[model samples]
Target: MTNATAPLDFIRPEVDRALQRFVDRRRTAFDDPDLAAVLGTVRDFLAGGKRLRPAFCYWGWRAAGGADDPGVISAASALELLQASALVHDDVMDSSDMRRGMPSAHRRFEKLHVDSGWHGSAVQFGEGAAILVGNLLLIWSGELWRNSGLPAESLASAQPVFDHMLTELMNGQYLDLLAQAHGENSFESARRVALFKSGKYSVEHPLRLGMILAAQSREAWIDQVCAGYGQNVGIAFQLRDDVLGVFGDPAETGKPAGDDLREGKRTMLIARTLELASPAQAQSVRALVGDPKLDAEGVATLRTVIEDTGALASAEELITTYVKEAVAVLDAAPIEAEAREALKALAIAATTRRN
Candidate 1:
């Protein structure tokens, strides 16, 4: 690939600068110290993500012959705000205690309530404050995107995609909740949840938004890329995440070991395990998977069940198949050479990371 710049090195600092400037400007508009604490917590949470969405957006623009432009960088950086908003809300939804090795937004707010001896239920206060913080980030994302200095026509062209992505995300989130409520554990149901909840927004829409902004119109090839390469990579990316949620170290993943098991997330891995497990194995999983007090021993037991069921191997194979198909599409795509190489590397990075 001839030393193509890694997106983390090339794009993250610029995105960080844009985010910092946005935060500074917003700080001036709000004077309350309590609000400042909320803002600061969100800001710190923003600092830790891999910045992969912006990277995909940038490469998609590049693939469409877009030049280096600060306007586009600013526009792409808005995705980080959108991501932060999702994570803060997601942590609350999952009741996750930590994020990026620190207290999650809700937990932090809950602690604040307790420490300050607030006159209300600390748990409710924390969750309410985190929801407001998430909403604030969502509002700021729109503001940043609209003010990104891109041409009005380009932004206008991409507006529908940007809007649709958010709609899809909300729909996916609700579907996920519904699946959990109903105890739906079929692989097909799990795949549906993965596709809408994380896959499409994480990859496909970001790529489409970037390409549409650059091309200033929809193209047949853009749709093809999104549907083929984008879709596969997105699903594979989420699958890889499901694996990490089970097997990754807390020091690296920034959540408790087997956090997904504790959350009772109906992920593809869990679905696959149930499909392959013996009656006793399935029974053990059913008993242990949703227990909030799952300790290292419980985690170890579930890990053994998942491993012995061959579900882990099956999920890994699926990830490989998806990545291979995505790469094959990229190989035949008529795009900029740098973008082609970068996209290939991105596919590997997305699916193979330990955390």
Candidate 2:
């Protein structure tokens, strides 16, 4: 790897190369062009991300003094493959048309079906393709984890954490779909969803996996410290995402303005808005939000309601509190100095990231 000229960039290219190499190898398993599209589409879908999970995992390893290990980096990279599966399946579940400012995987396959004049409903073909691709990525995520060149014993130790992470992720998805279906309008429910969906799976588990890989029988307090740190930071990260989904620039967020509102996502922001907004404003918003055909004007109307209700500031305050708590966890954490500073920067970046 040539110089990427940044502390975090050092790990990024290695992860990217691993993903690409893994994808290339997997492509060989399919000889037919149609079958090969699944691998190709997944590769493209995995191209862009902040790679926060992998970074957290890597930094956690460093915190445990397992510095500069190739096996750790490769294993950490596997989290991205898991993330790709989550997002692809998430898009299918949400029926999202776009991802990362491009056509979503399902949409791409749907277009492919229409352009090729293939048999059966284009929607069904597209959804089926996306679901299969998600499953393939899930399968590959495990393979990449196992093939990371770590000692068999060390990898074995991380197995339970990895398995639990996957289980929580799926359960969280079910909760999300359930909440959406029933229009359950509770802030507590949204927070629960965030805790399982993004907090545990995306941040805490990956960080813990790194620590476990580093020392299968490490100190208990150390693991507790990292878990607490990751949990708070992860929740703050997702809340920030909720903010972006509403107020962020479309070009940067890879979604339309107020996309969460349009989706009627029972996010904490929405719940807060509902809690704080006056009865009439709340009534008007409830009427307009989640309308698939809601125009920009309607989005504006809802944005004003959110602002007027003080939900945005409330959310920001919550983020600040969590960041402070996360930082406080590091004060006594049994980690080396250099890696601790790096982790601090990551906490800031994950919270402040624009995309």
Candidate 3:
């Protein structure tokens, strides 16, 4: 058999090229130097991603008997733009300083403000500019999807899924904010946030959109495939991310070690830790998890507490369970054999990645 990841590797360059062409075309529409800087930032931001969403969409189309087509690849690439928009806005909201080993959009803009000696507060200017950049990416994602050179009827057939995916993503972002503001840390709340914010848009909706576009309508099996395979794999993917946020390497993840803990993200891993922790351990985590000024020792202390409480183990078990569930679904799915193997590989890759 071909390498497990060959399918994803095959599509990545195609998607990147599509993104470059789209951005280049957009560049021709604007002439301002400041706008050029914004475009450059967007281009750079769009450069780094796993492209998992596009991979899922592509394989979904293939499974539905869609032949190889550049137009399909173009449509799939739009998901990367959507992903970029989400990340830029997420960094601004979280006050994140770095992403993919570079200064985040807001921080970059903030630096520009400082360097230019702008009159207003640098922080506010950075955040405002970053928000506008994110909005531009979101708008561009839609435009790209609509103008991907696919037939109008096929695009229309899949439009609702795309619309709903965006809606769910926004709702998930709000839910994440609310979870933090209200200090809601239940497993259920964490799962809900993961489902809307990342999981649906990350996997289920993308897959469904691809299938719908290929099949030219929402078929019965498409819904089953998404529900059975997409949901479980997506949630598992997020759970793995929760583990990485606390434990992943900075070199691999492209962020500071323990950055998510510093930002006080109410992730499932944290919720599970609190659930299983001793009173003293829970108190310690509560004191340390959200401290923006947390030092290496503080991070070490939390890591010990999470390990001692067995939350890490529990999270791993859940991740394994979800992936197993997804694999079982894939085994029975009527997808083309090659695509089935590719998706199974993707499920493992998504859940077990270091970054």
Candidate 4:
């Protein structure tokens, strides 16, 4: 199960296979034709993703002395299902058109509505469909975790961490919605939202999940070390996401160039820009950055202001600080050498990747 040469090479394909079999069985059990389309949507949504949470969970287990068991991988793969639920609901909330270079689940439902000549409002139907599909994914995620074929005791040990991980994700997402609604853009607020909504779910909890599944050590301090590393790396990961939302290439990012700006996201980048930009520049940015119909020229102007104010550099520096903090934790933790190296690689990838 353990491949010291390439820690993740065996994981990704095995995880994908596990997901395929899980979904196929579900598809078989739920045979309603109307349910069929929603199941299909959920399947497709789960098909393509970076699978970061599962990766972290796998390594965390390894670091905690869990062997390379397909059951561990299957349990870890449950994170992807939960992630799909989050993303689908998020796209619905954001009213996004695309995800990973294709129509978002809600948008696809909208098209289905229009194509089929449904009675009710297409937009409403799309949103409803998105919500239903998201709920289904969440349910299936729990199913995978509970029935992963891991030992009963291991599943029991991991349950609390798993439950809290999702609860934090939901709370964080709500905080994000509030930040947008209130038009809040302070760095503190942004960080709080990022920590709960993304940092914990994406990194912290997943690592903790793996650690719990291992049930190797009941010591409290070991859990702290894992959490510390996960939290810092999670912050760095979210920081990278915020930076990419504004500056990443649409082709690579699979999002509109100024999607975050248009969505009025109160990210660190925007908060820093507000702090550093000249009064007039700040005023102009405030007026246009959040407009739903923000244009290319508007995005260009905001980009210029962001660059001139050095907000981008500041954000990058913050990311570096978090990454360093995470590395320090890894260096001191009692992890296997190979597992430590894999965890370090995950941290680097989270902070530095463009998309």
Q: What is the overall TM-score of model 3 with all chains considered together?
A: 0.98
Clashes of each: 0, 0, 0, 0
- TM-score head-to-head 1 vs 2, winner: 1
TM-score for each candidate, following the candidate numbering: 0.98, 0.96, 0.98, 0.95
> Candidate 2: which stretches are off by over 4 Å?
1-7
Candidate 3 segments whose C-alpha is farther than 4 A from its true place: none
lDDT, candidate 2, residue 350? 83
Residue 254, model 4: lDDT of 78
Q: What does candidate 2's lDDT look like per residue over 1-355, in tens digits?
A: 1221233676688889888888887666887876867766887888887788898888888777785888988899999999989999999988888889888889989999999999999999999999998998899899999999999998998898899899999999999888888884778889989989988877788888888888775468767876789888988999999999888998998877877877878888888899898989889878987788888899888889988999999999999999889888987788877777777777787888787
Q: Decide which is better by lDDT, 3 or 4.
A: 3
lDDT of 4 by residue, 1-355 (tens): 3332244465678789999999888676668777777877877777777778888899988888888888888899999999999999999988888888778999999999999998989999999999988998899899999989899998888888888888888998899999888884788888889999999889988888888789744468557876789889998899899889988998888788999899888887888888888889889888987799999999999899998999999998998899888889989888878778888888887787767
| Candidate number with the higher lDDT (2 or 3) | 3
Candidate 1 TM-score over all chains jointly:
0.98
lDDT per residue as tens, model 1, 94-130: 9999999999999999999999987989999889999
Looking at model 1, the pairs that clash are none
- Cα-based lDDT for every prediction: 0.89, 0.85, 0.91, 0.85
Clashing pairs in 4: none
